[model samples]
Target: MSYTIPFPRTALLAALGVACLAAGGARADAVPAAQRPVGEVTMSVGPVTRTTAQGLPEMVRRGTPILPGDRLDTADGGHLHIRFIDGALVSIRPGSRMLVEDYKYDPQRVSASLVRFKLEYGVARAISGAAAEGARERFRLNTPLVAIGVRGTDFVVRAGELTTRAAVNQGAIVMAPFGADCTAQALGPCGSSSAKLLSADMGQLQVEFRPQLAQPEIKPLQGAVFATNSTPENGSTVVAARSVAAAPAPAAPALGRTDSERLATAALADGAVTAAISGQAAAPVPPPAVTPPPVVITPPPEPPPVVAVPEPTIPLPPPVLAWGRWAGVAAGDGDIALPRAEAADGRSVTVGNAQYNLYRASDGQTELARGLGSYQFALDKSAAQYSLAGSVSPATVEQGRLLLDFGNARFATDLRVANALTGAVGISGAGAIRGDGIFFDRSVAGQAIAGAAALDGKSAGYFFEKAVGAGTLSGITLWSRP
Candidate 1:
């Protein structure tokens, strides 16, 4: 016999409550409620994954909250687009790994904002937003080879363990290699002597930084660097002439019997015909030989009257110039002969060294298709220059359009530029195109206008400057065919 001691129901309930609390505490530790989200995934495709600061792995999707210290890894065909709280945009390409090292922003206190990002490998395009624009000095993008600092810019960068390549679509950027003078702890762009500046006005130039090189080198724009604009392995923005419509389903193929079946059917038909012929009664002999009908001859109908049809005249396409960048190459140089040169003037423009010579395209052909068309400003590749509190800042191009008469080689523009901190200005200009597809004039409403049509004649870029108040406003404009 055993004596039983009564247990309170309250004690049993308390024991179960303790176990549930322990389990819930563990989950809370994985994702802290105190940690604030820094950004959100606006677009995601393919196999993109994110690792949280506490080492929790999550599949990325649209609307995924991006917390600071979280690392993103994109698989072979993955792409991720993120929009930060401050309105900055960053797109990560396939096989890429990126981390938001640090971010801090306050709309009320704009000057104190700080933004930084690290690209471990692969490619990405960064478009500066409010935080970067408000505090340019405090913003930075770190890569393996260099640290990129923006000046109100939109740029693409490819980073690897040994090298880094950058191209600016709008505004400018300064890149400096990691060295004794430039440390990783620094914010914004490094101000070392090795720092090199690249601006949109440089005419399609890219900057490459390598560990072996003393300074970043300027290079011709590489088509591969601009592959983001093309349809990528994952879903990114695709450039197309027209929108594609959904296609209808194809009709089913007509049904038919196989060769073997047809042969068998033919054999049976032949057997039936032979049996019928053999079973038929014999026919009577013909009554007599019938008289033949009279033969008749008729001439062929007269041929249709010949008519000469003149062929439609077709116009030949205009000559297209090939563009390039020459460094340390001489004039009429065999290694780098001037493209489409009629004859070298023997006089070359020298920039730095006496060995280098640049052949002006003014002497080359620039005839293009004749038509009156309009070009809209590409804000992604356009920027305005202004000063904010005596420091150089990027101004906004509110609206701009160019009306060009290709037949007459004349152009007119209506552009409006403004700065939040400064005043806005409306600019109008008219110019005549040159034989080389260049347009230039010293004074357009007291401003200078100079630009040239692109090699394909579908785009144009120019630099503008004007005196405003006590300072000056200078900027670059990139226009595309509408």
Candidate 2:
């Protein structure tokens, strides 16, 4: 039987959850309750030492609850100045106070990350890697007013008794919508319980010094103001900008120089005053420029809390991919780079000295037609289809375990290949072909697997007519999950 934790996905628990503590409820539930990983996790604080339960590097000693003083850092050199660790680097500036429930990372599984932190009153910066491929690694911030879930790339959080604000800097994220739990059926994306109040409850949450949006962690430009402004007009609030004008020469030095030049040989003959003038003739070398001291930011005694609100209903549009790129070694064999397409009213796209006709057919199949001396070649497919066909014979489908075939050519399909959404390819009276994973051609001789599958083809069992020729696969990069 599957062990499931009775955790609430709603928002009512966002505030005042500290009173509802349970053994392993928050921490373990963050990792699906049942999945416990065996690995080394550390939390480091300050410059000198590392410790546990006390001091800087807190060990998170088994049963002990992580309190206000502890900070965490991981083996991958990730710095966690505050909060939990789900690849979310929470650097709390000064007086921020928060509670950490759990953090887990599993490199083996693409989605084995789960992190949760509850901000009571503080300023926190979160540089995140959330929902990033593996299991259910999520970064959550619990404020006095609401809960903030990051279904996004990166953002910053600041919350307090009077106010809570979360600003997204990169990628996308969402605060589970309010009023979500109003109905027993479903509240859609945001429920009434999911609505979070921002710019509220934050009494003295100053934006100064606290980075609302992130800044690159490099040595900031010295002798210049470290300013940050929202609009181009607000400019940066000068963290520090020092302009030291070159030192001026003493007035006596200039007069003394003119006198010394006049004294010269005559002074030796004439006598004393000339020697005095000569002795005073030198201009003191300007003291070597003092390297300005490193600026230290003394955080406020009290920092604000951070919370997130539901994103707007109309989500942003996706970017368009213009397949105008040409891929081929400078002096080697090459074919059209993939998502192999077919055409309708197409144009000639040149690669090397030759040009291939690219067509976006009305039926959505992409086609590539190129002439090579006596033989004319073409490959056609809708970028979504798992099947493809060449101008040659015997059409091929995805090989399921890993690979795509076209006679003798085999291309790695594990990550490099993307299943097409529409269209088909036909080379007529060819032989048998077999495969899986969105396979639309024939059947595979072996196993078949897909995150999701869709296949349609006919032959003896899969597809068999002529004697299948060669089998080959090529050109694709594997995307890893850690």
Q: Which number leads on TM-score?
A: 1
Local accuracy by lDDT, each model:
0.66, 0.31
Q: What is the lDDT of residue 205 in candidate 1?
A: 85
Off by over 4 Å in 2: 1-87, 130-138, 176-482
In candidate 1, what are the lDDT values of residues 1-482, reduced to their tens digit? 22111222233223212211111445644754336676778778999999987899999987787878889999988988787777777888888899898887778988898888899888888878789999999999998779999999888888876568888877899999776657677898898756899998897788877542345778677665545433332122345578789898898999898888667544334445666689964454455788999998989999999999999999974322221223333322222223323213432221111111223223323354455454443433455667444676657778877765566778777678887556788766777865445665444343656566753467665555565775556555556676
RMSD, candidate 2, Å: 30.4
Per-residue lDDT over 378-451 for candidate 2, one digit per residue giving the tens place of the 0 to 100 score:
12221211212542222233322223333332222221232233223222211212232112221232212111
User: Weakest 10 consecutive residues, lDDT, candidate 1?
Assistant: 348-357
Clashes of each: 0, 66
Q: Which regions of candidate 1 fall more than 4 Å away from where they truly are?
A: 1-34, 226-482
